[model samples]
Target: MDGQYSHDSRKNILEWSLPVIDEKNKSGSLEFSIDGKPNDFFPVHVSFVSKRNFCDIQVAKVTYIEGGSPVRFSSETSFVVDKYEIL
Candidate 1:
């Protein structure tokens, strides 16, 4: 899954979730990209691994560039799973 949002600030929040049945291991990646000319700003990236049903949240900050203004861009990822019991 993927998504994107625009804000006039240098920081943004992201929320996501994942579920596992009887305890399972899974891995995924979340990526953020800024639409603008390359400057002295550092690129932002992250990775994670987890188990069971849980909610994941993170805050993404836009890189500050000299004489640059915040602009619209695409960036976000998430997932969900259903847990069930069997006897």
Candidate 2:
């Protein structure tokens, strides 16, 4: 993966970005560890991009030609998100 890392100890700031995490379109796992105890990192702020959202519905339409033999498809969705935290 391509990444950029920078940190500022005076401001307690860490910037990390991975531009090319996965280009092959396959699910994978990443594991890492911190030196300190887990409780020391309480109230961490994390964010990521997602295509599917629980509050929104998505639909797709397919056609053989310009609006000819049109077929519509809608996803049968359910509640997601295994864990949620507010801090």
Candidate 3:
């Protein structure tokens, strides 16, 4: 994820780019449809631990850029977690 977002030594931030899933997939495409009906084909679960950040933070704003120039783009951000325990 290096060089994906602007660098700042005095600020704490993270940047991520989700992959584009399609009908030719079996996971990570819950927001898309398969056969007119809401696609509910999640055959797996994913979880992980990282050293990036523990507490969730609110985003200030979003900017879309292309070829070093401002551009138009749409994005959605959410924090989805079923459960997390420290034991």
Candidate 4:
């Protein structure tokens, strides 16, 4: 995880979240493309270790370029959610 939000960091980084269900889809990962940039991409990993491990999730999707702003783009492809753990 990235460091706790500093005052300046909050102004640049954007975060998104989705609920993960244990019985439905407990653990998995998603690959996403940002602003249609090939070089700029990342993965979101999700897992359920234990009840004690329950936590909120925040996904950083984009960042401001050197002298430009980050824009939202269509995903080049899609990911299937198939991994899950039964409670």
Candidate 5:
């Protein structure tokens, strides 16, 4: 499967989950904008080094961004979680 890495400055919630083995073996983090403000849940910023395919990525814990902004990867256009290895 093709992998995509990008850097995005979107303020949203990231949902990290296990990779899906089916359907081209594609996977990625679920990024969404915060609908409401002053919420209890805090958005987690993920960063890691990957060597295998995008589907093999290991989703790390939520890291609060210094600027409180979400940045995409640096591979393709979109981010693939199926091959990402959380470091």
Candidate 6:
């Protein structure tokens, strides 16, 4: 999945998350910062692989500097697919 954020100030923190794969494969979240002048945009990407017949849900949170304060936004999505079988 993908996400984008805009900030009005320099040096802002961004964070996002993906549903936990499991105890064995804990591949769930990410964070980073954008450093630049106002009107800066940042793009984020997330990807994962899972066993057949599995489902996953993901979410994203973006925190940025706006008007000298922190503003936050979030979104979530999910998908499911049947296992592939070859004979």
Best candidate (score: TM-score): 2
**What lDDT tens digits, residue by residue, belong to model 6 across residues 29-83?**
2344445754454343334344422444443344455645545656544344344
Candidate 6 lDDT? 0.43
For model 1, the run of ten residues with the poorest summed lDDT: 13-22
Off by over 4 Å in 4: 1-14, 27-36, 42-87
Can you list the residue pairs that collide in candidate 3?
A: none
> For each candidate, what TM-score against the reference?
0.21, 0.33, 0.20, 0.22, 0.20, 0.21
What pairs collide in candidate 2? none
Residue-wise C-alpha lDDT for candidate 1, range 1-87, written one tens digit per residue: 323333444564343334332234344333557665655333433333444225545444554497566655655545443442221
Best by lDDT: 2
Q: What value does the lDDT take at residue 12 in candidate 5?
A: 38
Ranking by TM-score: 2, 4, 6, 1, 3, 5
Question: Across residues 1-87, which tens digit of lDDT does each residue of candidate 2 receive?
Answer: 235666676965555555443447333333445577877666566555455564466666667676588776556655455664543
TM-score of 2: 0.33
- For model 5, the run of ten residues with the poorest summed lDDT: 1-10
* Prediction 2 global C-alpha lDDT: 0.55
Cα deviation of 45, candidate 3, in Å: 16
Candidate 3 TM-score, true structure as reference: 0.20
Q: What is the C-alpha local distance difference test score of candidate 3?
A: 0.38
For candidate 1, the per-residue lDDT at 78 reads 51
Clashes of each: 0, 0, 0, 0, 24, 0
For candidate 5, write residues 1-69 as lDDT tens digits: 133333443843343444344576644444445456644454445554334554655544444579656
Candidate 4 lDDT over 1-87, as tens digits, reads 221222234543434334444566644443434465533333433442332233433344665678567766543333344675422
Which regions of candidate 5 deviate over 4 angstroms? 1-23, 28-38, 52-87
